[model samples]
Target: MTTHLTGSRDEWLAARIELLKAEKELTRLNDDLARRRRQLPWVRIDKEFRFETDEGSASLADLFRGRSQLLVYHFMFGPDYKAGCPSCSAIADGFNGIAVHLANHDVSLTAVSRAPLAKLQAYRQRMGWTFPWASSSDSSFSFDFNVSFTEQQQREGSIEYNFAREPAFEWRSGKEGDGASARASFAAMTGTDMQTYTRDRPGMSAFAIEDGVVYHTYSTYSRGVDGIWSMYPWLDRAPKGRNEPSGPWWRRHDEYGRG
Candidate 1:
């Protein structure tokens, strides 16, 4: 009844041993990449960026919270949305548990969104999340970081993200399983249209402080953030390896099993 390959124990062990060699090589390569990321030149942040946090108005340096390292997850929750993006929410589900560990390691982890503080606070409470979240509602912090875009930029096909210019409207009509419909579905779940929903994208930025000066250290967007998705690493080691034929079957943790 099954068409999957079957092999003797010896054969399977031989194949697994070969795969282990490749995995070790990949692990070494990843280590080198991490080292390179740390060695990259840091860009000084001279412009002032502000945020609304539970503690009231805060500046970029304040985000470090006495730690030298600051990591901000650019959560996708634009002002127009009634809720946060499901994908961003999924990624954030892992944040609360990791925040304490990171803080102990001298890294402050926070989520930044373009939504107002009230909306973010309500949603954070609903999700039962304790991780620090800040609103960039009254600041150009999101735009400066290239995670939020303007209407004019979208109209003129000038939206640049992930170190590349995104096409204006082509992705909207892309075939199913290519992420177009999935994005639209996520937008609807967030009580927004695709355009408004996509105006804000997901990213994470790393910053460092030295001598009272703040500097941008690194950033990653789109698929580059896969390493931190929490579930994907486990899924990758599963028998079926992500197992999705229909693209993104995940929902916000609370939304699961309701349908």
Candidate 2:
């Protein structure tokens, strides 16, 4: 009763073997790209950026936590959002498990958001995540990274994200196609208006601290983050690889049965 292609044992094995060869090639190419990523030059961070965390106020350097390398997952939990973005939350669900191994491997992994420390703490408790989550509420950290935008920017269509300047997302007279519906749905989930919901963006930034100077090594956004998504790769091997037609077919790991 299968709806997909069916084949005899020998034919299936032959196809699988061919796929395995391509998979190995992709793996090698990924390894090469990773090496190139590490080779990207570093930009020194000179501004005095501060954040509020469970450990109290800390500087950008403090985020490194004695490790030379630091990785920050830019979580989308704006100051006005009642809850975190479902998509960002889904990505963050895997953070706790990786934090331990990364800490031991000379890297500190942290999640940074524009939400207040109190809100972040509350949400972290709700999600049962023990990894360090910090607030950039009192700082321009998110703005400097271009993951957070302002009302004027949204109105003027001057939003910059994913390393490109694009029209800001405004629900009223803007947004097109599935992007609009996805924004509306996520906005409702966060208990905020569409404009406010789109104020923050999701991304990852990597830094390296050498001789007490923090350097911005590399940053990735949009689909570049798919590697860390943790599930998409597995789904790619499934019978229907992420067969989402209109919008995202995912939710926060904690919210799977509301319907």
Candidate 3:
């Protein structure tokens, strides 16, 4: 039998009512944060970047697809990897459905990666996703955005990710320590080595166009992008509330054994 606490309906309702007050306060605070996010100053983008899309080739501005706003998911798929990151794949699974709704609302959502177009296409096909994905293989867009780092950056130990320069890790080809082992597991899942896996990091960026000028509005990396994950909000209300003591327990939808 389960050992979870049980209570009378009246007791449960009283506790729930108190929890509701906290939830409401969080909702209000979130609304204020969203307002502040929109009010943040945008940086003007002047670089002439190109990408390979299913539609052949396109410019960064073209990604807006005539919409005034663009949101790019910096998916962690490098040129050296045979597949997309498992974590990113799980996040992208929800995009196909939301992309349509966002497009109708004047925002275009696309995923940008450092992988070649052919590899991205194959992976997208395998995952059955229709969201627009563009390749920055020949462009400096990924580096400029700090989502893709170089070997030199790793050696210097001063790479900016998630907005701040992070300390260097003692990265090895196939290192076997706490962090290294976890990196190795993810790398193997994507059919790449640990070195290749660390080359690309996950992030999301927002852009806006005004008077034909493209401006970067905001970018978030690491756990900051968790709000975009469709599953988490639902799980937050569950009794166990993520219950992820063993780290990430999800895989690409197709990778799961359940039918």
Candidate 4:
């Protein structure tokens, strides 16, 4: 009854061996890329960046929690949004499990957002996550990292993210199921209009502290973050291989059966 390719066990093994060769090459290339990422020069961070955390107001250094390295996931929960981006939420679902291991390896991984600490805490509790989440609401930390943008920047097309300039968000009254409509639906899920919802973007940043000085080491955005998306690797191996014919057909984990 199946329309997929049917083959003898030996035939399948031969094809799988070919795929394994390519997979090995890719793994080696990724190792080389990681070495280059480490070789990238670190920029000293001199400005005072503060954050509100469960412990209280803390400096950027405080985020390291005695570790020499810090990894910040720029979560897209702007001050106006009633909820975090569903995409970011999906990515964050894996955080709690990894935090302890990363900490043991001399790295502190935290999620930073522009939402108020209280709001973030409420959302975190709702999601049953215990990983450290901090608020950059009263600081320029998110803006400095290029994850948060202003209304003026959005209007002027001056938003530079993922290491390139983005054109201003053009408003389109798209028909249902169009790109614009899909974006609008995501915005509504966050309880904001399209423009306001989009001002905050998602990315990750890395930092290092050496002898009392903090330095910005690396950052990545957009598809560059696919490596850290927990579900992607499994999906890549699935028979259907992500199976997203329409694009981004995922919801927050808990919302799967409600609709």
Cα lDDT, all candidates: 0.90, 0.88, 0.88, 0.90
Per-residue lDDT value at 79 in model 4: 97
**Candidate 2, lDDT over the whole model:** 0.88
Per-residue lDDT tens digits of candidate 1, residues 1-259? 7688989999999999999999999999999999999999999999999999999999999999999999999999999999998888989999989999999999999999999999999999999999999999999999999999988888889988888886784332233244777778888999998888889988999999999999999999877678889999999999889887555588888888998
Per-residue lDDT of 1-259 in model 4, one digit per residue for the tens?
A: 9999999999999999999999999999999999999999999999999999999999999999999999999998999999999889999999999999999999999999999999999999989999999999999999998888999998899988878787787422122233776778788889999999888888999999999999999999876677889999999999989876444488988889897
The alpha-carbon root-mean-square deviation between model 2 and the true structure, to one decimal in Å, is 2.3
> How far does residue 252 in candidate 2 sit from its true spot (Å)?
2.1
Per-residue lDDT, model 1, residue 249, is 89
Q: CA shift at 1, candidate 1, in angstroms?
A: 3.1
Tens digit of per-residue lDDT, candidate 2, span 1-259: 9888999999999999999999999999999999999899899999999999998999999999999999999998999999999888988888889999999999999999999999999999999999999999999999999789998999898887776777645432133334677778888899998888888888899999999999999998766677898877888888888777676578877788978
Clashes of 3: 0
> Considering summed lDDT, which 10 consecutive residues are worst modelled in model 3?
169-178
TM-score preference between candidates 2 and 3, better one = 2
Query: Higher TM-score: candidate 3 or 4?
Result: 4
Among all windows of 10 consecutive residues in model 4, the one with the lowest summed lDDT is 169-178
Q: What does candidate 3's lDDT look like per residue over 30-82, in tens digits?
A: 99999999999999999999999999889999999999999999999999898
* C-alpha lDDT of candidate 3 relative to the true structure: 0.88
Look at candidate 1 and tell me the lDDT of residue 133: 96
- If ranked by TM-score, best first, what sequence of candidates would result? 1, 4, 2, 3
Clashing pairs in 3: none
TM-score of each predicted structure versus truth: 0.96, 0.94, 0.94, 0.95
